[model samples]
Target: MNRFGTVVIGGGQAGLVMGYHLKRRGEDFVILEGHPRIGDSWRRRYDSLRLFSPPRYASLPGLPIPVDDCPTRDEMGDYLEQYAAHFELPVRAGVRVTRVSRDAEGFRVETDEGEYLADQVIVAGGSHAVPQRPAFASELDPAIRQLHSLEYRNPEQLADGTVLVVGAANSGTDIALEAVKTHRTLLAGRHPGQVPVDIDSGRGRMMLPIVMFVFRHVLTRRTPMGRKALAEREGHGVTLVRNKLADLDAAGVVATSRIESVRDGQPVTAEGDILPDVGTVVWCTGSGPDHSFLDLPVFEGGRVRHERGVATGEPGLMFLGLEFQFAVASGTIQGLDRDARYLLRQLRQNTVRSASRPVTVDRR
Candidate 1:
């Protein structure tokens, strides 16, 4: 088996950032990608999709986005392609990591192409890989044309009749707005809190610093009410439907506290009301971590436990690009540079230590 100092899994933004850092440090590492081409994930997004933050916030190590305005998905994809080429980061394309295990010496990563042994492993695949759907949604009549937000390309793909959009996050809200233009649309779930894309007023400018401060200091999952409010406002960017919730009143497109179950091809609400005759259901629910391929005891309480992105319990096992992995912006392009730098430092330190240590041979 070929040996590497470090192997980064997933060639997305996180993985690329980590690769760039490794290259800068003159470290021996390889990036493993599952897709046929790099940055294909960004290209596959809906044509109208644009970055939530302005391009000023979208950058990687040693490179900056050309545009200050919000970049479209295609622009971001092209930028990533250029970044990869500019840095000449070593990437192995079309190699799917089937599993990762640890031996006495180091880590063994199994892929369809072959097996690779590395002293350190970094899992950089972000959260979007696993598109989550509601459990009750599975029993729905397959004829109803249910789809997750990840699969949705455009409103044209939706059915001809009325559609129910569940979960009002950014994707849900954006899809609902788009569907309303083509099909009769009903948006479910609580509305999200939002601010204008660009606040121009002096008061708005003053509030910007305060908002950032609050976002960084006060708003956190540990705070109960703050977390609830944040969850409710997860998809605040999607513009609200012009029609008021009271006007719909659960009739045209009803909102429920929660979906209880599905009966006879209809969605039953927690209030015992059934939404019947709906032609399509689009689940915009959130996703969960999928680490089935990892065979290490690294995760704790459904999340990978780490100190500064380095797995504490498992040495040489690291995770990059995890949401809030290190700081408030851990997973985003802006935040990944710093995280990658820190991880690269840890990897280099480990490599030096391993090389310096004496290897003893076993005597029979």
Candidate 2:
């Protein structure tokens, strides 16, 4: 049970696809998921969360998300459950890989339950592993309630006071828009660019397919615009999806520049102004991959350096589901199959090439 030809760490979309491909290739692989159940990543999101893409775009390889409209959080969790069951993926849930290190055996992955040895390791952890927040957040008043977007399930988690949602990404806007329903909310940050059209509106509905076509086809690592976008968005968020600046504007959520810091027991903006009477601070800034468990020097400028998911330094190691790992949709469920298949091809070639190599015996 501890030995495998490949060990995929994570049971989300990326892990599932990796499992599917590995199984198809007849490789002995196991997917280790930290959560007790599949799709916990989506299930744990703030309530009222909905996918921007319709079922057609939100689906995984060979499995369509059965939602007629955009899927809800619970429905997504359900779909993941059904997908795992349908595929019969060898996913061992609740087995968190605490540490990963290379060994002569290929790789040693230590989990909470036990240890697993694999000839190849695929770091298939979903894109959002670590929830990011600002350093100045801790400087806020001890009386203020602060929560990272990951910890935000619903507005019920907040106190009865003005809510300051920092960051203008998709989650930030969503949370701000939601927070305004019950509490006075202020959104401060470089608002991520919005789609030119409202997706829910008639004009926007017509444009959805075009957007997908662009992201899936035009916006790829191979294209110049895509490469430029990928480089620029490393510090920025994707263009607003499902919701837009117009929604926030109509919702009465005050939008402002980046939060400079806290002053006089209040939130301050980069514009030399102070936000007073803020009771809660929701840090919807962003997140990054948690490769802390990885004991390799593959990191370059805060990202794992790989040529389309294939690990560079480690021969038997690979990566998947990284945000814009190759294309605009590379981190999404739709892109999982494409990236997984490419990595599988590379992995199989490596395996075959390794096996074919002449065995050198150290006869000393």
Candidate 3:
């Protein structure tokens, strides 16, 4: 029960697609998911969440998403569950991987329940596995309710007062728009920009194919534009897709500078003004790649050093579902299949290279 040919950590879209490829190859693999259900990750997001990508672009390798417009959070979750069930992928739920270390054979993946051994390991758990916040967050007054976007469900979760959203990214803007209906909302942080057209509109829908092409092909690791984008992708939010900064203004959601520090238990802005009336603070500051449990030397400056999805330093380790792993669409549902296939190919090459290499003899 503890042994596997391959251990795909995380049963989300990334892990699932990898599972599909491994299944086709008739490889004995097991997908380990921390959640009790397959799609609980999506279900745990904000209630008003809906994919910005339209249904045409939101599908797995074999199955199409059964909706015309963008799918809701619940729908996306359900779709993933359906995808797994339909494929009959071997997904073991509720198994949280605590640590992954190397052994003579391959990997020793220590989990909360027990140990698992595998020849190959795919850290497909995704980049946003942990919620991120500033260290100064603890200095805030205990009376103030705080929630990361991961934990934020809706405006109902906030206290009845001004809601200060700490990032002007897509998630921050979306939450601010929602909070404006019930609370005086302040959206703080500088946005990267906005998509020129309304994706939900007819004209936008017509242009969707072109945009998707750019994301999947034009702006990729192989392209100049994509390389430039990758350089700046760190610590910056993606351009606003559905909600624009203008929309926040129209809805009376106050846009402010980034929150600098906690002043007397209040949030002080970069411009020196202190927000005194914020009852709830939603930090959309963003999450990073959490591979702390990975007991490997493949990390460079805290990020896994990989060329595409292949771990440059490790022979049997691979990654999937990372943001901009190859292109801007690399983390999206539409891109998972491509990434998975590419990684599998890399895995095959690694196997071939390992098999052909001559063993070294030790001199006494």
Each prediction's TM-score versus the true structure: 0.83, 0.93, 0.94
State the lDDT of candidate 2 residue by residue for 147-251, as single tens digits. Answer: 999899998998978898888888899899889999999898886788887787889888877877787778899999998888887678777877777788999
Clashing pairs in 3: none
* Cα lDDT of model 1 by residue, 160-205, tens digit: 6778888765677667767776667777666654464343345555
Give the 10-residue window scoring lowest on summed lDDT in candidate 3.
Answer: 355-364
Q: How close is candidate 1 to the true structure, as a TM-score?
A: 0.83
Q: Cα lDDT of model 1 overall?
A: 0.72
As a TM-score, model 2 comes out at: 0.93
What is the Å distance of residue 334 in model 2 from its true position?
Answer: 1.9
Put down candidate 3 lDDT per residue, 41-109, tens digits, no spaces. Answer: 999999999899887787888888899889999999999999999999999889999999987656899
Q: Lowest-lDDT window of 10 residues in candidate 2?
A: 355-364
Please give the ranking of all candidate structures by lDDT, highest first, separated by commas: 3, 2, 1
The whole-model lDDT of each prediction reads 0.72, 0.83, 0.87
* Better-scoring candidate (TM-score), 2 or 3: 3
Clashing pairs in 2: none
Which candidate would rank higher by TM-score, 1 or 2?
Answer: 2
Which candidate number maximizes lDDT?
3
